[model samples]
Target chain A: MQLTDYEKQMLGGENGPAVARAMDLLVRYGEALGAERLVETRNVAGAFNASTPSIRSMAEDGFDRVYSELNLDSDDVVDIPHMAVPTCQLITGIDIENHALQGADPGLVDMQKDGERFFGQRGINMMCTCTPYQVGNVPVRGEHLAWMESSAVIYANSVLGARTNVEGKESTGAAGLTGRIPYWGLHLPENRLADRLIDVQVPVEDMAGWGVLGYFTGLQVEEAQPALNGISATPTLWELKHFGAAAASSGGVEIYHIPGVTPEAPTLEAAFGGNPMPDPIVFGERERVATWERLQSAEDRSVDFIMLGCPHNSIEQMSRVAELLEGRKVHADVALWVHTPRALAEVSKRSGYTDIIREAGGVVMSDTCPAISRRLPKGVRVIATDSAKQAHYLPAIAGVDGWFGSLEHCIDAAITGKWRGGP
Target chain B: MPDGQSTSKIVMRGRGVVPGKARAEALVTRQTISGWGGINEREGSVIELRHELRGQSFAGKVLVFPGAKGSSGWSAYFHMCRLNGTAPAAMIFTRMTTKMALGAVVTRVPAITDLDGDPFEMIETGDLVEVDADEGIVTITKHET
Candidate 1:
């Protein structure tokens, strides 16, 4: 672990006590990861699982405690995505319903308070929600960066070709404070090249298809980065967003590529950086079905809940759901809710998208999702979701039957209040 | 300690997340735990439905898994375990995710990742194990052995 003159000076307390402390942590993180040098990050995003009200209250408390304990001041705030002050008006009603903190899990609320207070005291803006790309922190195609969220890191690395490491929370906060990260792993241009080629001949449409494709790729490569040879045009940032989110949700990877979308791979050969292409895995219709089959549990019983928006739902996704249930109503017996960032929720409200969903009896909430709040609604016997990542873990954590499938299946369950298995 | 502990030297490889030492019973999970609401905040036990080791305590166990599944707040769940006095003795992961890594660092637990052998298979739910993260080795002694 070598440090530059500036880094050494900072470590020596030359850059004020606050910065010096942050730098110390970053240096330790860098050493832990075996990084040789440090690099500058242009922008940073905030958080992925937002907290609920009870959780928010707890966060505020935690902030106050950490504030007094550390005697920290306001000048140390970091300019990042989710931490920014609420730029958009927020609408909160039923969105926090199905989460782990339904009636306010006291411990969870306290933890949330701890997080909120920590960031608040540190002068970090607490804009609640995931999908920081909607607000800001949009890394240009091919920029070097460091971010915390799995979806964000994968999207930046795979679609934008921006280099990054899936560094965790503390490191992200530490990096944001100093605006520097270790220049190793994906940050290096040479490390971004594709080691495996994933050829997908199956139809790539619906968001679920892309998500399934990601699962397939992740399962095949395990943790290695792969280049997708056959695919439709480079997906929009939104589509790539879901793909990356679902992919990283299921597997451990920082980058993947479509022949044209990623900057590193303007062409197939270019994506390889002129290196030899690894053997290709032909992923066809059978492979898609097999992937789906592999994920299905085949144990279907009436489910009490269904959840969506793992990385938090994008505005467009919310709009689509709103349109689908324009005048219809959700299953009265089953609980159905949508999750969105506070900023996006404001936009949806102004646009009347919130009203449309609300009028249909489906509530939309902002600032927190189920996974973070840890507050599931009362009497949830079984839970089903459109996200494999959610389906994979929710059952184990929530103590219920975790069913998997696409939006249609989830909506059907939401409509009938019964798990009809998969289509 | 039991006399002549049934310890076996099984070489496993995993990318190291944090560098330290930890030893305890092996608690391997193929079913990834949900980031939120998965573990009891106070009890540090698996409460999630369908989890292989549901109702089991993580305390003093050498937790093994593939990687973190969802939520960037994944570290917070483990942090709660630390607060509840049920933190794992150590951890071995086949892959490293930012959430899992943060949990390891925040919890100040020893962890070794990128294992050469499939820990999900080599380790069982209740095998005594010692994780020497400094040497990147997981020594497991099966209960029945």
Candidate 2:
């Protein structure tokens, strides 16, 4: 890989040992991808938090050790410098204030707080949500970003028309320090176009429908860009967010085109960028039903927990949840927790969404989700969630069988403590 | 040394991203493996509910699959597997994505890709295999001719 003069200087240890180590990791990672050069990136989001119990020993050593080893994949224990570019922390493992509710160890929570302070001092914005675009750092069309979190990467590339591959922890860490990522894969213009198309035969009018479509699309084309046709409804940020997150969860899809809906694809013909499109895979009623059924692993109707707002919720979603929950209490046997971005959680507080949900015996949370934290309600053997990404992961990560359905279904389950929703 | 064993050895070539060698039983799967929500790092087992290798630990085996799929947390999970001593002895994957490449690098395992021949067709789980990633070669010793 050809490094610029400034990159060479950094790799040669002119800036500091940390920058040099960061550059070194970039070189190896770039070469592994067969990239010929590195591109400058001013935006980066990554998992820089040391919140997991597995990293307790390293955290005991110091946050620097955690950053050096986990982020840069280095062993040198270099003092982390201020980020060279704009950087933000993605969804962390534990919520700062709700650890007790999630049954997390207090020691781990304290370690996370320390990590945030150390890294935050180094200029990393603690956005603390997977959906950073919803919170504020919205990148414009054609902007290059180095980001981790597959769901966020897919959302940025597909909805926002920003370019980013699904970067790993080490790669994002390196990019945050060096402002460079490999100019390969999705970073290149030629690779972003759809090579195939999918025909949506069923009406995908709601967020749940979009989630099913996204999951089905992923199963049809793993890692391949595909444009969707036959969707009649105009989707809001909420629907597209769920769509992208669900797609990335089921498959490693970084970019997708909705033809008329997304920014890059103004028309079906434009979606392919002049390449010959393959036969359209049919995502009809059967496929949609199958995909929805595939997401639910629970057979027992009794629900123990209902988790919402994966990729974290937008304020509108928060309002809708609060509306459904007004004057109602969650089932005494079940727990209901609503998650949104930390910034939006504050807004929810002022908007009375938090108060409304709390009054109804549900909790409003931020900074983390059960899947990322692996911290479900204690003794949670069965769960239900509106988010397809959460449904796909929570069952596997939290050791609980889960049901996948819409917000109404989840909320109803929260009220009755039963998995009455179905495919 | 188990020298002069009656089994025939065949050496295949590929692009070796990480440099090291390990001889272990092959745990082959045609399906792509997920790293984050798909596996238990401490146990080194594929835990994705419906994955073909569900509940199977790859700790001491040469994990042969079609590279990583699902979450960008791929590398982190594999990295943790290394820390926990539950990582695959070597990784032999067909496709190389940023997730798998970074994962192989951080896990510090012997990893090879871009094979001249189809590894899935030639290798099977429980077969003795030796991965020499430093030289980009895999020697497979089948139990039956």
Q: Who wins the lDDT comparison?
A: 2
lDDT tens digits, residue span A128-226, model 2: 999899989999999999999888899899999999989999999999999999998889988899987999888887888888888887777887888
Give me the chain B TM-score of candidate 1.
0.86
Total clashes in model 2, counting residue pairs 3 or more apart in sequence or in different chains: 0
Model 1's CAPRI class is acceptable
Count: clashes, candidate 1: 31
Clashing pairs in 2: none
Please give each candidate's TM-score. Answer: 0.79, 0.98
| For model 2 chain A, the run of ten residues with the poorest summed lDDT | A244-253
Q: At residue A212, what lDDT does model 2 achieve?
A: 88
- Per-residue lDDT of model 1, residues B1-145, tens digit only: 4689654666665556677888788878886654544567566677655467778887888888775654454665676566558788888776554556567766668988777877877888778787888888777777774
Model 1 chain A is weakest, by summed lDDT over 10 consecutive residues, at A84-93
**Predicted candidate 1 versus true structure: per-residue lDDT over A1-423, tens digit per residue:** 677788788678776655565576666556656678788775655442224442344244444333221211123432222221222111112233333435755555455555555555555555555566666556687676656666767877876667777755555555655667777788888888888899888768776677778777776775577888778765655556666766665556668877776777778888788889888988898888887766655365677777877667778888877777777777877777777776777888898989987876676766655554445678887787777666655565555666777777777787787777543
| Positional deviation of residue A396's Cα in model 1 after best superposition, in angstroms | 2.6
